[model samples]
Target: MTELVRMTGIEKRFPGVHALKQAQFDLKRGEVHALMGENGAGKSTLMKILSGIYRPDDGTVEIDGQPIELSGPKAAQAHGIGIIHQELSLMNDLTVGQNILIGKEPRRSFGRLDERELNRQAGELLGSMHMKLDPKTIVAELTIARQQMIEIAKALSNRSRILIMDEPTAALTDAEVSELFAIIGRLKSEGVGIIYISHKMDELKRIADRVTVMRDGEYVVTVEAADTPVSTIISMMVGRALKEETVTIPDLDTAETALSVRGLNRGRVIRDVSFEVRHGEILGFAGLMGAGRTEVARAIFGADPKDSGEVFVHGKPVSIGTPKDAVRAGIGYLSEDRKHFGLALGMDVRANIAMASLGQFTDMAGRLDEKAMQATANDYIERLAIRTPDDRQEVQLLSGGNQQKVVIAKWLLRDCDILIFDEPTRGIDVGAKGEIYRLLAALAADGKAIIVISSELPEILRVSHRIAVMCEGRLTGILPGGAGTTQEEIMHLATLRDAMTEEHA
Candidate 1:
């Protein structure tokens, strides 16, 4: 293996923070190098510098033993460097071929796009990766996995010698992840250097050749993946030893039903879903993406209208047609896409937290009680351990984990008995995820009926009192709270989404 990329003495600074401090990174051809760290640890910042999105205040980047300056994104692309961001960056209305070959399309002599050639080339690229999809297919028509495959194809199309993937498997299913690993194996065999940035420790052990740990904007150490234990990696990344333990609460077997849905139906998204959540239970909805887990939650919370379903609270039938109706019925929903749906990003933390319960603070004359709202928001900020300078700070400025806490705080302040959390830990860091888990555990112990929908099997297993698996809009199976339920069981249900057998029917 030869050094394909070397970045030394990288230093970046903001107004009050050293975003990166003398950080160093190295990548070798034909190897998968993993960068591990918590959120705000400056992993992304360092990679941005590599991709020419940012110029380091101080550093030297050497490629093939020659120092090179990356002035911009185009320069990086010309140098055979490419990055696939954590969020998919595709135009939904465009065709797959257009997205893959954007900016560098094949053109005819007249300078017009040669559509046939473009499609043929894109199809070949997909075929090479063992992906079965039409290049002419609209991006919106593809699954998340297929879209990710298109992203990879786009990178390869750019003749990327050094590829950077940030949380590439975050939204993928087990089968999709396996396919991605196969593609990675092929890339490695072809001597393509890959920089994998992920919080998933297990993935590093499975795929990476070496692991580079970063903490608080500084490189801590680098070690062979096979020789280093996950515990060692975690300690290096966080600058402290962190415990990996599951927190369990006592069984709430005899608790009253907080929310019950009978025959919940929402077109093709949710079908004949029926479940009951008891008070003090963290009932987890486990399945792959597009499994209707989030759809079920939306229907139950009245974020979307269901075709037919009966919702009950304390055995009393309730009519919930909208979010207001759900709230009136003592239900609150935290959408998975918190930035877009759950929170008003531009609003201050105090405003977001008090948004749901504003009416409670209004007097008989319709006068707003600013003092009461501030006090309430301040209380939740302290209790949730939200890392914000002040409640007056905008939610957008806070980290992903803190923003999620604000959403949770809003619902908690509203006194909602049935809480629906959809991918509550998505985009959250490892350390922050643990804190959120602990908070959820405490909430369940306090007798809140919690329905947690998560794509991460480990998170679902660690947090839930019981696990319910959904496949293609149907509830396939429900398992007990304890260690009997495994990731394999959930995956089995996730993949069995085509159709139910006659016996099952």
Candidate 2:
């Protein structure tokens, strides 16, 4: 293999934060090198420096045996380095081809925009990648997986020799991930070096040639993916060995039912969904991407109106037409897209934590009780192991896991008896994942009926007392959740829709 890229003695610092310290990284042509680390471990920062988004105070970068200095992203692109950022950077209103060829659009004889040539170039790029997408289609009209493919295509269209992919499959389903892996293999064969950054151990094992682990803004070690164990890599990332956690089988059969949804019908997405979560029990909703788990949760939480359903709390039917009614009925919902639906990002931690249940922290004169809110926020910050500098810090400044903890704090402060967590650990690191699992277990132990909707089968198995499998918006089966529950069994239940309907018919 050819030596393609290298960074040695990299150092970067921000206001009150040393983001990277002497971080070392290197990549060979045709190799997929994965960067592993916990949240805030400088993985993204190192990549940013490589992509010319940030200039390291002290560092040396070399490409193809030649030392180089990049002024900005365009300069980096000129040097054959391209990065697909974790967040989608596509212009929603623009056409797919227009966005892809935005700056490099071919011009006509009189300098008029040559739309045909531009679309042709973009179309050729997508076709080379074996992606069948309409160049004239609006970027916003595409699915997340397709948009991600566009991002990758845009990066490669720059004629890059090295590509940096950050959590590329974070929002993709299993089949989409497989397609991406195949694309990655093709890129590798084309001699394009890739720097893959992800927290998923399974993905690392499957797609990575070598794994580079970082800890606390410093380089830890690099090992062949086949030679390194997941446990060893995780230990290196967190600077501690992670114990294998098991879901405790709680005695929920005799426990009182806290929340029950009967005949939940929501426009073919959630059809005849019925389930009961017992007091002090953790019920896991497992399924594929569009399996209706989140729909059921939204319907129960009144975030989405159900076509027809009966919701009961404590064995009594209730009317919940809005989020306010759901919260008042002792139900709290934490959405999967926490930034948009579950939090006030611009607000302080204390304010966001108290946002859902501010009525309790209000005086007789309708003024918020600042002291009480702060105290409650501080308490939960400690309880949930939220890594925040202080309660006064903006929620946006916190990591994904900490922000999720703030959302959980809000519902707990409201004293909600039933809590529904949708994709609770999405985009969180492994160490923080353990913390969240522990918090959920503790919440259930405290008698809060918990419903966890997750796409990750391992998470569902680790956290739930009973797993409810959904297929095409219908409840297919309910299985015991534990180490004994295999992923194959869960997948079988996830696709048992036609058979289930025929059996019922």
Candidate 3:
């Protein structure tokens, strides 16, 4: 009901990019105010300024109608501000209690860690949120969802009155999201002002009181959550409307099987996962995160070592122990994390495109044919409609969707017959999502065996010819993709097996 935090005329600039321009944001006490924008829209930049991660070139910050200067994160923390970053900042080797209550450990007289007392404090903090994680459990051994919970616990330990959550539900399951929402509601009741940033529209309607949309580093509009339509919000955030429609899948019933995996196993992530993908089929692997979908693809593409598995390409068994073998077998893998695994961020688009199949563009003298490589990259760039100032630009400078196109271009240029796309549309805008979907459909139509791994149930239903769901380390069931399939049905199979069921199986 009262103003808890406000930033007026906030401006931040990087080397050549004006990241934020006079952005205005205000959060009321006990309210969840959502910050909406596409990637590079300055949502994170603006919030970082507020959290003292960056010093704004120009701005005025006010808390409780009083102007305040935030010199650093410590200052922000002193002012009751806490931020849960998009990426988990936990030390993998540390225990949950140690990470959550870092630097604030209760010491007993001497310099001892006071292990029992530390866990007791941590347990109380988790208990407040109804979390059952043991404080002494190693963070490395925890699931992504559990790690996220620990992040939240760490934030709450600060006794923060203003919480900034960036894409909090990015890795959470439906059930876990619900649990988080419950905690958020409790925080709201306790008069905690929350700044929530997410691309998920449905969540805003459920949790947010007000919505603020930004586009092109400028604040667009602010509207009450109850009154604004999701479509209107999306249009404002992306500067355009997106028609959500299913991609057109070509007829591939008679296409020959392109890839066949038999008894695939990678530790406990994947177990006996066997499937066949036809040349013109888009086989979708649908499940919750850590359901072995990505693992299966990585193992097949030889990104990860297979404990035991056999891969067959076009009816012939292929020995794939490394990525080189997979590439020779005409297989290409598009990693889920584009920034880390998919592309070389430091290299130009043409170089990255030619990376996978450099031999094709190399002369007998072992020197690269720059002109030929540029021509090839340019052709695919134009064909895929990749938006870039020039093909010479670095792939990292491109937008999320455009970077994904570059990754796809690299594989396609390598003449890979079987392609695996993992979370291809993640961090991509809605309009670009459609473009990527169309690209995938066209690739399938051209007889490229396609395996798509996605967490979005709607994506799986729309683009897949056949759907496979994994639970724990096992492939539980497969469904015919169409109108008959539902998200609930997929989730049922995704979490079907527990320890007891695994023993029985």
Candidate 4:
């Protein structure tokens, strides 16, 4: 294989932060090299330098064995480099063909836009990549997975030989992931080098040829994927050994029922859902995508309207027609898409922490007590082990894991007893995941009723005292959470609909 990209002595700095320190990375043609790290490990910072999004304060970038200084994104693209960010960057209002050839659209005589040629070229590119999308379809009407494919199409349209994919499978289904891997295979055969960045350790085995680990903005080590253990890679990334242990179910027979839901229904999305979480207990929700796990949580939290249901807090029925009402009834919901639904990204950590319970920090004259808010925010910041310079730091500057902790702090400051966490560790790194798991356990031990909804079966087993499985908007079964419960059992309950369909046939 030929060397495609190399960066040596890469260094970058921002105000009050050293984003990268003497970092180094290299890629070879026809290889998939993975970059693994914790949320704040500077993976994005390094990649930004490679993709011309940011210029390193000190470093040398070489493309195709030739040293080059990339002035901007266009310069990098001119050198056959393309990056697809974690957040899709397509214009939703445009057609797929228009987005794919945005600035490079073909023109006819008299300098008129050649719409037909544009669609034809886009169709050819999608077909070559084995995508089944029509070029004329509106971008906003496609699913996340399909939109991801379009991003790839757009990258390939630039004649890119070096491709960088960041968290590409985060929003994809199993079938979609298989499709993506197939495309990667095709690209590799064509001698295209790929830099894959993802937090899902399992993917390294399936797709990556080599794995590179970075920690706290510095290069650690790189090794062949086939010769390294996942544990070794994790240790290199987090600087410590992580204990993989199952949950120890506590005896909650005498515990008070903190939250109860009965006959919950919302159109066909949620059908007759019912569950209970006792004080000092963690109840896990497990199911396939679209299995109504999130829907049930939203209805219970009053984020979505439930056609028919009764919510009981402390064994007493409560009316929760709105999010404010649910909060008043001692319920706090952490949404799965935390960036959009959970936090004010531009606000400081102190303001975001006090956002949920502003009234508590306000005096009779309607003036906020800034000192009190700062004191409370700082306390939670320390208690939660949030890695931030101070409470006044912008939440957007923090990593994904720390931002999630801030959301948790907001709810805790509100003093909600019944907490519902939806995909609490989604998009978070493994090291941070352990911290979140510990936090959930401590909260449960402190007698806070908790409901955790997760797509990953192992996470559900690790955090829950009891597991509730759903299928096609209905509760299939509930099982004990521990070593006694296997992933197979959870899968069976999750695919109950398929089993029933076969039986009926």
Best by lDDT: 4
* Alpha carbon lDDT at 118, candidate 4: 97
lDDT of each: 0.86, 0.88, 0.86, 0.90
Q: Can you write out model 2's per-residue Cα lDDT over 171-268, one digit (the tens) per residue? A: 77898788789888988999999999987889988999999999879999999999988988998999989898998887776899999888889998
Give the local distance difference test score of model 4.
0.90
Which residue pairs of candidate 3 clash?
none
lDDT score, candidate 1, position 30: 96
lDDT of 4 by residue, 1-505 (tens): 8999999999998766788999999999999999999999999889989999999999899998889998899999988999988767899999999999999999999999999999999999988877888999999877556887888789888878999998888766677788889989988999999999998899999999999999999999999999999999999999999998666788899999999998899998788877788999999998877788888998988888999999999999999888999999999999987887899999999999999999999999999999999999999999999999889889987888999999999999998999999989877899999999999999999999999998777889899998888899988888888776899988888888631221100
- Candidate 2 global lDDT: 0.88
For all the candidates, what are their Cα RMSDs to the real structure?
3.2, 3.0, 3.6, 3.4
Candidate 1 error regions (>4 Å): 247-249, 346-351, 357-378, 392-398, 491-505
lDDT score, candidate 1, position 163 = 96
The model with the greater lDDT, 1 or 4, is 4
Q: Estimate each model's TM-score.
A: 0.90, 0.90, 0.89, 0.91
Note the residue pairs that clash in candidate 2: none
Please estimate how well model 1 matches the true structure, expressed as its whole-model Cα lDDT.
0.86
> Number of clashes in model 1?
0
lDDT by residue (tens digit), candidate 1, 280-332: 99998887778899888888778878999899997999998888999998998
Score residue 110 of candidate 4 by CA lDDT: 98
